[model samples]
Target: MREIIVLSGKGGAGKTSVTAAFAALARDTVLCDLDVDAPDMHILLEPTGTRREPFVSGHLASIRAEACDGCGECAARCRFGAVTRTPDGRYAIVPGHCEGCKTCVVLCPRQAIDFTPRTCGWSAVSDTRFGPLVHARLDPGAENSGRLVALLRGKAKALAKARGLDMILCDGAPGIACPVVSSISGATLAVLVTEPTPSGSHDLTRVAKLCDHFRLPTAVIINKADLNPDEARRIEDFCADTGRPVLGRLPYSPDVVRAMTARLTLPEYGGPLAEAAAELWQAVVTLAAASRPQLQPL
Candidate 1:
């Protein structure tokens, strides 16, 4: 199976929306949202049959109030300074602040601290119109989001393989962050979505470099290309210099916003935006066909 990821340099670059449009247009594909930290792809896909399970990451620290004895000992030992005094004057461990290093747990003179596996968030397998969708939600302040991204990707691949699906369409997290790296690990093709903005141009360059580091085939999609003609030209020039093609461009349109407000895709919105999205999807498919042989799992 071929896995293609839709990524952006930063948030609000229209990565997920473009991904949703692709999902709507692509045939025989499984959907994945690897943006575990801020997953919103399901909003457009409208996933159903969701089965959620806890995603346990590193350990968390808990304090036994009775055993703490208002001890300054645990507080002093905590490197993260997670141990805090409660209103009741007992020592407590802040779940958000604690790094779960277990140093306080190991050194507590009163044996007040407890270390347990952290249920960082929940991962869900769901059904979307495109196919099975693998997605996740991480708790606020949770660490190890890279693992969560990998987990969802693995799940999506497994689902695709089980059903003999041809493609796995993944909506990736914004920026060249840890989760974004994890999202591209096994992708067959990487599509970097950008807008006609200087920041967009800069970020696209950064992400394109990252794709090169992974030796992955990459393409570019310029959204709202007409909004800034000069930046669009710069982006296209950069892509040409880097040997990554600017496969397609979409002009600025308020109908995308209308579709978003109505919880539908561009095609469902039924207009020029949908037609353009179809053309973009064709370009992605053509690129994927040419690059499929290079799509080895990393």
Candidate 2:
């Protein structure tokens, strides 16, 4: 199955809206929202969750107070400074500060420190107005988001395989960080949704470099291209000089926001903006197909 991930170098680049529009148009595809940190695709898809699974990315070690003899070795050995001295002269492990390292468990002279798994987040398989969506919600102030993203991708791939879907359309997170890296790692193609501004140019360069790091084929779609023609031209020129394809340039339209406010995708609006979104979808699908290795006729 082909996995096409929509990403951006920064937030507010209209990645989620475009991904939702593509999901609305694509046939036989599993829609995935890998932005666990701030997943907003559900806002448009209006998914009714059918299956929920706990996503435990890692462990959070804790000290058993009842078993502790107050050796304080674990506290002293913890390099993360996760251990704190309580007012009663006891060393306590902070859940937020714990890095899940087992060093404290081994170094504790009292052998009171035990590692326990913490719930980092949860992923869900939901039935949306469009189709089945694989999405997640990360706990606030949680770490290991990259691992969580990878887990969500795996679940989406599994759902696609089980249903014999042709593709997995993923609404990826913004920026060139770990979560974004995990989201695009094995994607067949990345559709980069960008805007026209100085920050847009800077972030685009960073995100493009990240895509290149994975050697993934990438296409650009400049949202609000008409807002700043000069900046848009610069972005286009950069893509041209770098040999990256610009799939479509969508003009700024208030209709997009209106549709989003109504919790609907652009295509669902069935207007001129919808037509533009449809055209963009076609280009994205064609690019994804072209990038795939063609089978040789026997």
Top candidate when judged by TM-score against the true structure: 1
Worst 10 residues of 1 by lDDT: 289-298
Question: What are the clashing pairs of model 2?
Answer: none
Question: What is the lDDT for 64 in model 2?
Answer: 79
How well is each residue in 1-298 modelled by candidate 2, as lDDT tens digits? 7999998899998899889999999999999998989999988888885698998877888877788777789878889999998777778898888888889988888788888788988989999888899888899989888998898888888888888888999998888888899988878998899999999888988988888878788889999999999999999988887778898898998898799888888998878879988998898888888855332221
lDDT of 2 at 260: 82
lDDT of each: 0.87, 0.87
RMSD of 1: 2.8
Residue 256 miss distance in model 1 (angstroms):
0.6
Give the range where candidate 2 is weakest over 10 consecutive residues by summed lDDT. Answer: 289-298
lDDT of each residue in 1-298, candidate 1, tens digit only: 7889998978999999999998889889988888888889888888988999999999998988778778678788888878888899888888889888898888888887788999999999999887788899999989999999988888887888888888999899999999988888757899999998988988987888788778889889999999999999999988877777788888999998999999998888889989989998998888888844332221
